[model samples]
Target: MKNKKFFSAEHKKYLRKTRLNRLLISLGRWSVLLFIIGLWELSAQLALIDPYITSSPSRVAKTIIAWAKDGSLWLHSWTTLYETLIAFAISIGLGSLLAILLYLFTPVRKIFEPYLVVLNSLPKIALGPLLIVWVGAGTKAIVLMGILICIIITTMSMLQSFVAIPQEKILLLKTLGANRFQVLFKLILPHAIPDFISVLKINVGMAWVGTIMGEYLVSQAGLGYLINYGGLVFNLDTVMSGIVVLCILASLMYFSVATLEHYIHKKRNL
Candidate 1:
């Protein structure tokens, strides 16, 4: 009973320390962000920097407020969000499926391995004009661009995870008479969870980049469209506002993945 009590106290102390660390880390992040914003605002106010071109935080906030009041902010945000989510979903789903297929068929993997490498290395932006011409300058083209940017990466990441499974484990499963499908479901898929989470985190940024790039090339409405339009009109504040929103959205996505990772780790510990 005394030993158990001792361990219990130690565990509680460890948990408290962990929580405190996390709290301090979050505070530090916020402090840095606030410091930067405060400095930017001060610089602009002092005329040390040009607010018109550089765009102070206050001006950007006002621009966002105006957009919010006119409902254009929500409209553009939703358009970009919709495209990003679809692209994210497709990248994860189709990429994992392709990875699984490649793992299942060695000959196919060999045949497409070099091609995939080449595609992944190719600058996706170069294909923008062709995509617009082929997909006709619409949301489809935008979503496709996002998918094209991410799917290859997702496929490669997932396939690496699948292939990295220990040979001994596979042999053991086989020695126990486990077939290919059984080995995959019982061991491989489960093993890929952590890797998949990491890939999700990476794809979040890639998805946004692809979507925004598509919008820059051919978009009627989206944050990217707003930024492009604002630039054309010399509305620096509007451009900054769109960029701020994009950064916030991307940060949110990254944090969401981090939360999932934390939850999974906690649950595993439990």
Candidate 2:
């Protein structure tokens, strides 16, 4: 007890308030979710809408349970998850490398900047057919589609973050006789991290879009294919189940990134 430190009364009060605020925020989120779910189920029970077409929450859940029993859920889930993760990893790796290269070479950056801008603006969906012809109908095409959707944005976003570093900082480092590589490692890379995380959050959605689009075109497996197949047969339950599962998966990936951001923020504050 003697070795322990105690906060002032005001500090203790503030801490209590902070905890209460966090509790309230969590409660609010759950309450809203429950309210929506209750409303949906109630509507379905009353036949407010056609559950056959709209697919009620219970119907979706039942379908999901059915999939779980049959094992297709696991297979399809793994296929989509695997392709997405592969594309995500490659996009981040290749995009960051390209950004660094552009940052290090002014002439090359100047030459390619316009083309990159145009390509980034191009509708990537239009490239789906081209990708099919080039890579054949399969995971290669799907993963490439996913990569194409986000890689340019990643490169541009990261490059801007690096360039956004105040010129004064660069001059200071130069004044200290730091080389370009030293400045990059010590300053630019660290400063760009927050932006990199933001780009990651954005790319999560883009990756899903690309992968799903590819699956729509040629995939034999994955959530995207499941959804497409369901729609073709008017299997509302299956379609809704696939959609719900996709949402859950995407939410998981997004929250994972958010968790990383939170951890980084906490470490920085510490």
Which regions in candidate 1 have their CA more than 4 angstroms from the true location? Answer: 1-24
Model 1 / residue 76 / CA error / Å: 0.5
lDDT of 2 at 238: 90
Error of 1 at 177 (Å): 1.0
The models' CA-based lDDT, in order, is: 0.94, 0.93
In Å, residue 214's CA in model 2 sits off its true spot by: 1.2
**How do the residues 80-199 of candidate 2 rate in per-residue lDDT, one tens digit apiece?**
989998888899889999999999998999999999999999999899999999999999999999999989999999999988999999999999999999999999998898999999
Q: Backbone clash tally for model 1?
A: 0
Candidate 1: pairs in clash: none
Please give the range of 10 consecutive residues that has the lowest summed lDDT in model 1. 1-10
Candidate 2: Cα lDDT at 110: 94
lDDT of 1 by residue, 118-193 (tens): 9999999899999989989999999999999999999999999999999999999999999999999989998899
Stretch of 10 with least lDDT, candidate 2: 1-10
